[model samples]
Target: MAETDVISIDAAQQLATAALIANRTAPDIAARVASALVASEAAGQPGHGLSRVPSYSAQAQSGKVDGFARPSLERVTGSLVRVDGAFGFAYPALDLALDALPEMARGNGIAMAAVRRSHHFGQGGLHCERLADQGLVALVFGNAPKSIAPWGAKEPLFGTNPIAFAAPVPGSASLVIDLAVSRVAKGKIMAAEKAGRPIPEGWALDRDGNPTTDAAAAMEGTMLPIGDAKGAALAMMVEVMAAALVGSSFGFEASGLFSGEGDPPNLGQTIIAIDPGLSSGGTYGERIAALMTAMAGAEGARLPGSRRIGARLKAEREGMEVPRLILDEVRKLAGGQSLSRLD
Candidate 1:
């Protein structure tokens, strides 16, 4: 096992923020990104946590991500909002959208936000959960750089798009469902490679389209989709909803996100918030509660976000155990040490 260091969440965020600022990210933007990364870590998603600092910093230094860029928003209709990320990190843009969306949904009973020219918006479930906390049902779709191929062909064409949904229950924690179209997120393979570990065979296929257990090989190849064709179909759906609809580059057109060598990914994200009171007429809470009760009664049925919630609570109380290597790298960045390579 890798040697790990336990760090308080606030301290981790401080380190991340300092590292980002040293790498040319604006202070405000750095803070937002740091907060999101830390939150993802607390939720047991290390792939999107501190591990991302090196690449993100490298991207900022390379100008692939405009560290100083600020997002702008527009209300196109009574229930439609459009945000331009201006080639910046996605956290600020998403925060801008969320700040306006809840009120819009409450007023119009349904509100949709389309974000363009954005970078990665980590852990989409968190976004939905925020809406659910506001007494709204929320859905989010995001498309990334191409990493998955259509079911029939070998050449990669679709991203491992993610879909997230969240809904509130009368007096309980919101239910959040988040899934990646790929059998597993490519980040996991990247993490394994960093740790010199082999990935599971079924997770990815080599360049020749044969399944492989080598993490390095998996990174160079295409990811397997969940439910075979069905997952691929879902990726397409996200592409249309997020990229096509929002005038962002298609997955095939975007650059790789893990490197600082190419152009900005120019990804897109679409968020929809619905006021359940409008449709359910006060019965939504009761219905959701009943469903929850039924699931709780099942022998071993675990709620979708239950584990994540538990992880968050534990992290809050005991801090996070971050890999020592990763922590050292972030510390170096925070200390203004430049990395020769982000990989």
Candidate 2:
């Protein structure tokens, strides 16, 4: 066994890919999903990282997720696309959106893609950053498994829906903003539960509608909204934009994220891409630079996603660590292969 958990990035992806393949995921799709999970790890978002593999593999093996599902896309218009994930993991569906977005944006000035029958969208920023890399501004919205309540209610009616936006920053990294509608993402709470830790107050209320510091209780209860009623309203808006408008299941109708007990989440996501020049002629970058410059000058002002981007840089050089237990579990899923052999 490796003495330290500090694993190379390649090893992480390879381990994840092998585990997905063992669970019956198609080779290509498994690789894509693995890479996305590894990318999540690189971005300092462990909640969406490799820790997801055991549940994902279990779901795939149990037939709760169609490991071989082929995502299909249809253009409803020059500027709009509809994608069906065929009940697969969401990364492949997102790959379809990312692949199609730039060309559609160039042709139509703006383009939108609606994805349904999907699974968890690991991280919004990565999806948006891809389009931004193509010199277009992008927005990504995803509805997750339900873990939040409507304002003034105890029912978990909405997912901790996340939204992300990105734009090229001229000669620098893209400006990206990704956020969950809840006060804190439910994944963080789940991670805490796995680590056997208590959650902070104000993060959630137990099923009886009372606050609890227990992580497991928080998972069984309602996640507090970020800005109270405002976040609830935003979550409702996402329920409409990503689910109702896309013909996908509402958060309340979806199964639990960590379980294979019910139907597939059959969730929805929306991605919008726009050519910067469409709205700004040729001065979009200049306008953005001015705003960024001003923001840089403002006291205590820091750009959103700065720390996330920084972590990516760090992960690239120093790689990252995967707990020995997680690595062992995934390796076992991958035919009980040794890490040395798997890598």
Candidate 3:
């Protein structure tokens, strides 16, 4: 197993950005992606954290990822925008979307962003949370490489697509909802495999369609949906919004992200931002707070994303723990000899 150790947030981002730069990724793009990865790590999301560095480096070096690609934005008249990622990392494109969303939502009461030719969007909710901080409710959907099969199918068709939403609470932390339609994210299986651990049996099935606990076999198979048919349908809905509506490749047409092979995944993401005051006459925040207050009053009731918010806060104050082996690999990839971590 990889030895676990603590590393400061700054060190995590720095080494991650350095490794990407060493692999020929543009500095700005690398910084954006590295920041997102670090945020995921700090939020207690290991599946989308430093474990991605090695694969990203290999993809960048092998031309499976266009390290120097730039995202471009176009206004689709009023209230709508489209950002093309140029088949690079998704962070730059998502950043462009976030930058353009607030002003449009403020003026038009609603706005939508369509991002195409993108790579993986590390944490889907983080993007929506940005809009929430700007006083807008945001819904975000992203399509990834195929991993989950549709309901009643043995063959994989739809991606383990994710959808996230966030709403501002006026004074406190925003309410955020993020979920992968699959039983769990495919990256968690990948993480378990890397850490030499087995996954839970219900998470995925073997290639022959039997449920398995072996992470390796799970990776080669299909991920079960969260709510049987319901989750599968939701995954397809997001797939259409993110891929078909955005003119990106479908999940079945995309290449695998695990290996440096085929064309770039060319995924798609769609974001919707709505000004709550537009319809609620500025009382939306208080209305939602009432429901939250009632829910919190119930015995043993915990809100969604509470743990993630707390985890992020603690990581900010106490730093993050990453595997030492992962850090060594990152340093080696970056051609750096230092392996020091700050307290």
Best by lDDT: 1
What are the lDDT figures for the candidates, one per model? Answer: 0.90, 0.87, 0.88
Q: Quick one: RMSD of model 3?
A: 2.4
Residue-level lDDT tens digits of model 1 in 1-343: 5678899998888889889988989887888899999999999888788888888999999999999999999999989999999999998999889999999998998999999999988889999999999999999999988989998989999999999999988788999998899998887777677666788879999989899999889889999999999999999999999999999999999998887889999999999999998888878878888899999999978888788988999999999998888898899888853322221
What's each prediction's TM-score?
Answer: 0.96, 0.95, 0.96
Candidate 3's residue-wise lDDT over 129-219, tens digit each?
Answer: 9899888999999998888888988999999998999999877888998889999989888878877788987999999999999999999
Against the correct fold, how does model 2 do in TM-score?
Answer: 0.95
Runs in model 3 deviating more than 4 A are 337-343
Clashes per model (N, Cα, C within 3 A): 0, 0, 0
Worst 10 residues of 3 by lDDT: 334-343
10 residues in a row with least lDDT, candidate 1? 334-343
| 121: Cα error in model 2, Å | 1.0
Output the TM-score of candidate 3: 0.96
Candidate 1 wrong stretches, greater than 4 Å: 336-343
Q: Pairs clashing in candidate 3?
A: none
